[model samples]
Structure formats: C-alpha cells, structure tokens
Target: MLKKIDRAAAFIQKESELFRCPMCHQQLTAKEKSLVCSNGHRFDLSKKGTPYFLKHQVQTDYNQAMFQHRRKLIMNGMYQPLIDVLTPYCEGERILDVGCGEGSFLSQLATSAQLKPSVGFDISKEGIYLASDYGENLFWCVADLTNLPFQMGSFTRVLNIFSPSNYQEFKRVLVPGGKVIKVVPGSEYLKELRQAFYPEDETKQHYSNEAVIDKFQETFTKITRKTLKYTFDIPENCRLSLLEMSPLEWGVSPENKAQVQKNPLKQITIDLEILIGEFL
Candidate 1:
C-alpha cells in the first residue's frame, strides 16, 4: 500500500497546476512533501492525507462522531433521490465539491457517475480528515470557500450541497458554460426534526428558499431549479444516528435530545431544491 504522504504527493503532482497560493494567487508546484508557490507560500499535506489551505485555524461544531453517522446515512441511500437528480448533470472532466463535509456526497457522486479527477474541500479539518479516508483517486483538502486555492476556470462542474455559497470564487474557478449544481434545503426539509425540537417556535416550523434562489439569480444566468421531495423511512435503531448527524440538534436541550431518542421518528422528510446555474 502507498504511504499517506506518497498518495498525497502523487495527487499534488498530478493536479498542482490547478492550485494557487491563497496569499499571492500564484500557481503552486509540488515540492518534497509540500505544495509551494513562487511567493514562498508553502502548504504541507497532513499525515491524514489532506492539505491545509486555510489561512487561519477555524473551530467548528462539526466533529468526527457527527460525520461518522452522516457517512452511514448517506451511504445507506438517504440522499439517493438527490443523487439521482444530480447524476445527469455531473458530466465533466473535473468536478469540485465545495463545503464537502466528510466527502460522502462527492465520493458517492464520483463513483456512481464514474467521474474522474473529482475533488472536494471543506473549511472543517475534522470533516476533511474523515473525507481523506474516501477514494484514493479523489483529492480531499481543508480549504476555505471564500478563498479557493485554485486557478481560474479550473472546474467543469462545481457542487454546492447544503453548504454556504461563494458565488464570486465559484464563478472565478468555473470554465465558461460550466455548471454550478447547488442544493438548498426546501421548506419541508427536516420538518419532522424541526417540529420535534422546536414544537412551539412558529418561525422554526417552516423554511424559505425564495431568498436563496433570488441571490442565485443575481450571479448566474440560465438558472434552473428542481425540487426533490421524499420521505425516508427511518429504522428504529438508526433514528438516534440521524438526529446526531444534524447540526440543527446541536443547540437543543439535553431533555429534547432524549425526547427525540425515546420517540423515534418513523420517517423523515428529505425535501431539497437543486439549482443549476451557468455563467453569463
């Protein structure tokens, strides 16, 4: 088996031209165990097989335990409906998944769609650490969305799934006519969980996509929106794992958590809207 550093070095050597120095915007080249740029900015690949791209350390509420359950849920086909909708548009030479937590969606998409040179990055190091254990062919990195460490027009398809959007950076790194497959939570997404946690909070009972869609319109042309709504029957034993996977439950009271654990949900809604955007 190739050592972790060896695998990382190979990936960097193959795709180094696609990356840029976040500090100086210069092309990066793979050196001994590091990606270095003309400006002397160097990024070292971690022992876990992910490169550090963020300028500063960021603390996140997302932890390994949470991501582990997320991987299980995704692998078991919780988001299969969404994947089906996204498969057709996944055609491209290079694909990028922004804010790819644990790389579950991107890894599945790459494998199912038979895509090569698939790359995924997240601001959370914990998430990227888990993601590095995914396919060896895919490149995983801990990177900030606002300041992507890539060259202009680098990707043919950019995926933004239930993650924050950085339109400017996205557009900068997308080829002309490249597609941005953005997934946003629909109004009914996780309604059961919301109701369980915030039963009396009227505002928390519903969601709105109008604002998010409107913002997309401002930056992208030929925008198309598709709604994917489904109900996933939760196995009695997996209900707790589902609850733990969601960041929404992070701030809930311990009593509320126990309540959800006790009265397991039979089915959970997976309502989402996928927006396909092309640059003008």
Candidate 2:
C-alpha cells in the first residue's frame, strides 16, 4: 500500500544520519519516497515500503513463503527463551539487526523497550516486505550484508540472530564500545528434525558451530558467551511450518519430506549460543 511507503518516510528522514550510500559511501538524505546519496545514488521505496539497497538481484532459497513460515515459527514463541536472553542488551539502545529476515526478532526486542532507532534489513525483498507487516517503530530495507548502508560508529548494539555475519561491516557501523550480540546454534539445535530427515548423516544431524564461534571470538576484543537450551511443544497449527521453515529441509527427498510432515516431531529443541562483545 502507498500508505506503508509514507508511514516509514518520517522515520527514515529522522534517522537519515545513520545511513551511508552503499555505492559511494556518501551521506544519504531521505526524500519523500527515496534515499538520495550526495553523489546521486538513489534508492527508492517501492514494491515494499522499505528502501531497496541491494545492487543486484539476490536469488536464494529463502523465498517469501519460507520467510512467512519462519516468522510464524518465531512468533509462536519458539524463540521466547532466546528472546528472554536478548532483552537485557536491547534496553534503550539503538540497534541494527543484520540478516533480519521478516523482522520478528527485532520487533520482539523493540517490544521490550523503546528503541528510538531500530533497523532491520535483509538481502531478500520478500523478507523485508513481510517485515513491514510486524511493526512501525522499525525501519525495514533490502540491504546486502557484505556492504551495510549505515555509517561508521552508528549504533549502540548490533543484533545478528541465526543469520550470516560480516564482522567487518558490523564493526564499520558500530561506535567504539558498541556491542555485537549474535546467536549461534548449538550442536543439538533442531536435533529432532535433523534426526527425522537425515539420521545417517552425522554432519546433518548435528550443527557445527566451531568455525563460526572461532570467527566470533577472533573478531571481537571482549566477548561473553551463553548457551541456552529449551524445548517447545509444537502446536498443531504450526506443525507444517516447523517442517517447512528451515533451510535444512532443502536437502531432504520429497518422499521423506512428505512422510515426515505427516508425523513431524511434536517437540523441538532450541539450543543456541548467545555472543555479546564490545570494544573492538
């Protein structure tokens, strides 16, 4: 709707200072329906109310339906324990969530406190479009992770939940002493589904967070890690979403997927590591 485009215009104009031109790295000014950088690189707010910033079309398996299912799974309180862990860091902070598909995580964080500046962006336009459906306090955009569009030293906290990370880009947008809070999966994350789909494949059954954890440790100067484990009883309505939500499903055979869907796991494990670091 045209109204959605205008709804976020005021927020963009107010927080225009946080943005940098993705192409030229110049300061950007928010116009009526677009963001124009000094060198004249303009990204319009069309298709979705959010500004479109990615230079190239991103073709990925995380399509609109996947994002919809993912969002439903999140909002169903599957991530409430994870949310409880993330709430303390978000109090009164200007936060940026990279790979913030469908905006569920940031929206939940925003509900915990009043965050004047909250922005969530993903490479997929579909995800951003779905994101706009959640809340108005946050700004949604289609942005590339490798080249974030925010200025250096802009946010107090940057959130990356179950998404890819680019430490350099995150560091570039955060001020000195700002924290990076990331969520990495534990080995048993979704073990039930993994066992159902890929029981024989050792690698497929267990998530390997070794490389990612090592990278997170190496990228920040000071960091804290917390591992939280919980299990949620899947409601009947969301059973299919559980089956369709994860990218891990992409590898399963059609027959296996159908069979499993008919008898999907009633409970799911939420094993995750929360990393918080600052002073990089």
Candidate 3:
C-alpha cells in the first residue's frame, strides 16, 4: 500500500507544478519540493507526494474514515455516468472543479478526456489528499469556495458536483467564453436514504429549480439542463461510509441510523440534474 501511495504522490508532485496560489493569485515558487508564494505563504508537498496548500482550516464533524470509505464506493464507477455528461464540455481546456470532494469525478474527467490542466479545490484536507491518490495530473488545493484564489477568467470550464454551488465567485474565475456545469440532487435522489432519515419526505422542498435558474440567468447566456439517473447495488460494508458522506448524517438521529442499518438497500439511486451554461 505504501509503494502504491508513493507512486501516487510522485504523480501529484509533477502535477503541482502547473498551479499557482489560487487565492493570492500569485506565482508559486518551488523550494525544496514545496510550493511558496512571494507574500511568505508556504505550502509543503506531502510525503505521499501531493501539494498541501490550504491556508485556512474549518473544523467539521465529518470524520475522515467516512470519506475514505466513500472513496472506495466512488472508485467503483457508481458516479461514472455523471462524468460522461461532464466530459463533453471539458475537452481541450483548463478545467476547475469547485468543491471537488475526494477528487473522484475530476480525476475521472482528467484521465478520460483530452482536457489539459485539470485542477480541483476543496476545503477538506482529506478529500484533496484522496483525490491526489487517484491521478497525478490533477492540481488539487485546499481553498475556500467563497474566496477562490485563482485569477479572474482563468478557467474554461468549472465542475460542481454534489457539492454546494457558489455562483458569484464561480462566474468571476471563468473566462468570457467559459462554462459552469452544476449538478444538483433531484427530488427523488436517494429516496431510499431519505426514507431512513425524514418521516414526511418534506425535506425535498429545499431543492429549488427556480434558484438554479435565477443563478444561471444572472451569469450565463445559453443555459441547458438535463437529468440523469442510474441504479446500482451497494455492498453492506460501504453502507456506513455512504451514510457518513451525506447530509443525512447530520439530519438523521441515532434512532434513524439504527433504522437505516436494519436494511440499507434496494437499489442505490444516482438521480441528478446537470445544468450547463455558457458565460455571457
């Protein structure tokens, strides 16, 4: 496992050379295998061989072990269909993945397409590290979504998966001809999971298509949307991890968890809507 990790680290080190400080918007200088900035900010390359440059850390109840388990499930192609919808817009350009958790989707995007300079940023250190393991060619950073470090108009395409959307800063970094591809949960996304957490199924009220459309109308000229769905059987071992990676973890009480553990599956649903819009 250590040797495999070493190769992964080596690959990430090579990829790190392609990025600068996204926040400071400054050039990064390589110093003894670490990346540094002119303003005295320093980011060290990990022994595992990935660059670690998250300037601010926010504490969350999210345990690392849970996301590690999620990495396993995601690696198994459970999310491949989402990527198939994403790759068409990313070909032959620099792509930035905002909230790129564990790098699953973006790493797949980097390897599967002719896209150049695939970069991913997340506030979670663990997520960025796991992403490093998947592909060396990806530029992974730990940065706040609300205050992205990259220069204005730097990316041709941006990917926001199940992660929350920050449209204001998203539009700022995208070039004039750039596009932002956003994925949000559909009403029935993980109905089985919701059944385990909420009694009335009323929490579905939070997903707003109007909100998505309004955000797009403010920034993009041509907006297109599509919904994609698929099903897969999840193994019991992964059930706990799946639980932890979701907002349902916080929403579900102890008794609710016990109910979910009683029977964790029928078919896992990957229902989502992809909104693709071009910057005006």
**lDDT ranking of the models:** 1, 2, 3
Provide the overall lDDT of each model, using Cα atoms, as 2-decimal numbers: 0.87, 0.86, 0.71
Which pairs clash in model 1? none
Per-candidate TM equals 0.96, 0.96, 0.83
Top lDDT model = 1
Candidate 1's residue-wise lDDT over 1-280, tens digit each? 8877678788888888789999999999999779999989999989977889988899998898999988888887889888888888885458999989999998877877878687899988989989988766788899988899999998899999989998889989998898899999999998999999878776877869889888887878889988889999876667778888978887778888799888878899998988998977
Better-scoring candidate (TM-score), 2 or 3: 2
What value does the lDDT take at residue 78 in candidate 3? 69
In terms of lDDT, model 1 sits at 0.87
lDDT of 2 by residue, 157-240 (tens): 999988998888888898888999999889999999998888678878865888999888888877999999999999888988
Model 3, 10: alpha-carbon shift in Å? Answer: 7.9
- Which runs of model 1 end up more than 4 angstroms from their true locations? none
Better model by lDDT: candidate 1 vs candidate 2: 1
As a whole number from 0 to 100, the lDDT of residue 224 in candidate 1 is 90
